[model samples]
Target chain A: MKPEAPMTAEQSLALITRMIDQAKGNVTRNAFYFLLWGWIVLIANLGMFVLIKLSYPYPFAIWLITIPAWAYTMYASFKRQKETSALTHLDSISGWLWITFGVCIITLIAFGYRINFQINPVILLFCSIPTFMSGVILRFTPLKFGGVMFWIFAIVSFIVGHEYQFLSGAAAIAFGYLVPGYLLKRKESQ
Target chain B: MFDELDPLLHSQLRLAVMSLLISAEAAEFTFLKEKTNATAGNLSVQLDKLQEAGYITVEKSFKGKKPLTTCRITTKGIQAFEKYVNTLKQYINK
Candidate 1:
């Protein structure tokens, strides 16, 4: 890469193409976030289902776990920001997109009581947007499949009864986030 | 009938640097060095040259206790790169 080397037009095109492909950036690190949220929500969904089946009074209280998960996500993001040496434009946009998704989820939670807490379907529907968008951004097919699964499961939750809605939500998170998350983790590791 | 290539982007290492910077929002000095496999001294010198031409902006700051240098391509750099590519395309297509 010496500056003095005379590069021909063809060589210049080759170099530009090689360098641009190399600059695709490390988007695979997103696997960790996907896996984290996937597991957390998966557990919460199944936990609510179990509590409901047991006739527990505070079945909905299971969602309080997201508070700690949110704190941990923020702390990890700050630490990650410190170590990142480059920022891709697509990555920046994806980060902002997820932030918007978080705002939407919060809005849903605040207004859930008005709809009699029929939040599972709406939450899964919101999840599909960022998941599908990230797949498009990263050119990862599994994530797109996961996004499709989320949509299907959202519909499933709408069709199911109260206690079974959590079960449908659990299946949604399993296929949507957990499955893609694991695949992404494996791909990144490779 | 062909436009001349921009001399600043006609060389090997500088062109590689611009290529990397053009695609990224920002890249660190170490990242460029690692990707280019260029010596630190040489990369630093070439970066200064691009900075002088106003083709890129270099920021020097501290990342914790260590110094960090980040580079980003400028609007002028994009234009120059584009012009150079168009010119090169003319040469090769001829």
Candidate 2:
């Protein structure tokens, strides 16, 4: 057996600092999830925009793509959980925020038609909550700004006519998801 | 007067491990090894010591065909770590 050496207080403190930094670095490796959802929501919004522009008989039907998107998200989350042996507190909080956001969205969609309100605006409003909270949790300024941008777009969507709401929704996703998602990926790579 | 540090967390490797675990919900054995730059044998010994002291919990399960070991800090461990840090602070201030 190797002899154990006692560590000085300074050395112990340094070791603790280094280990904490390492744990924080590990949290960024999961930035890919932001990219995944960003692309999905972006595509869905653009698709809906095109359908509405073409005067498709069932323009609203395009939103159904989100169903498959949700399914794929569930599958990906489970797969990720299986591959990793540990989760950070940050990871757990971020996951719950998104999950709660998902539940709110599904509830909104299910009951939206009866509320006499435009769904996209409400969705955009709801989107800001989790986006901002995630940004705060991750301590990433870009995400926080992205969340604020979504709120601005949400108000715009509410003021504009229903036909133009899709465009606003698309813009919200662009700023809130795509931009920050790419930034996060770049930060992780560097 | 210098407060006594908890012996279980006084060593370099164990303290480093506790520091990593303090912020995380849990961590894998591989992660600990990678962060600590310790050999598997050495890390296993240190982790066993921590587990025996009730500072951490080790769970063994199979991930597909390979065996997996994950470690999580216990509530007792958190309190001990906090006390250790506070004691260290006192020493530094003195």
Which lDDT values do the candidates have, in the order given? 0.90, 0.84
Candidate 1 per-residue lDDT, tens place, A1-190, comes to 5679888889999999888877885553589999999999999989999998899999989999999989998898878877888777777888899889999999999999999998989899999999999999899999999999999999998999988989999999999999999999998889
What TM-score does each model's chain B reach against the true chain B? 0.97, 0.97
Candidate 2, residues A129-190, lDDT tens digits: the string is: 98888888888888889899899999999899887887888889889988998998888888
Scored by TM-score, the top model is: 1
Write model 2 residue lDDT over B1-94, tens digit each, in one string. 6889898898878888899999899899988888788889988999999999999999998888989999999999999999998888887677
lDDT of 1 at B27: 92
Tell me the chain A TM-score of model 1.
0.94
Interface RMSD of 2: 2.7
* Candidate 1 C-alpha lDDT tens digits along B10-57: 988999999998888999999899888999999999999999999999
Model 1 TM-score is 0.95
DockQ score of each predicted structure, in the order shown: 0.85, 0.60
Q: Which stretches of candidate 1 lie over 4 Å from their true place?
A: none
- Model 1 chain A worst lDDT window (10 residues): A20-29
C-alpha lDDT of residue A86 in model 1: 78
Fnat of each candidate = 0.85, 0.62
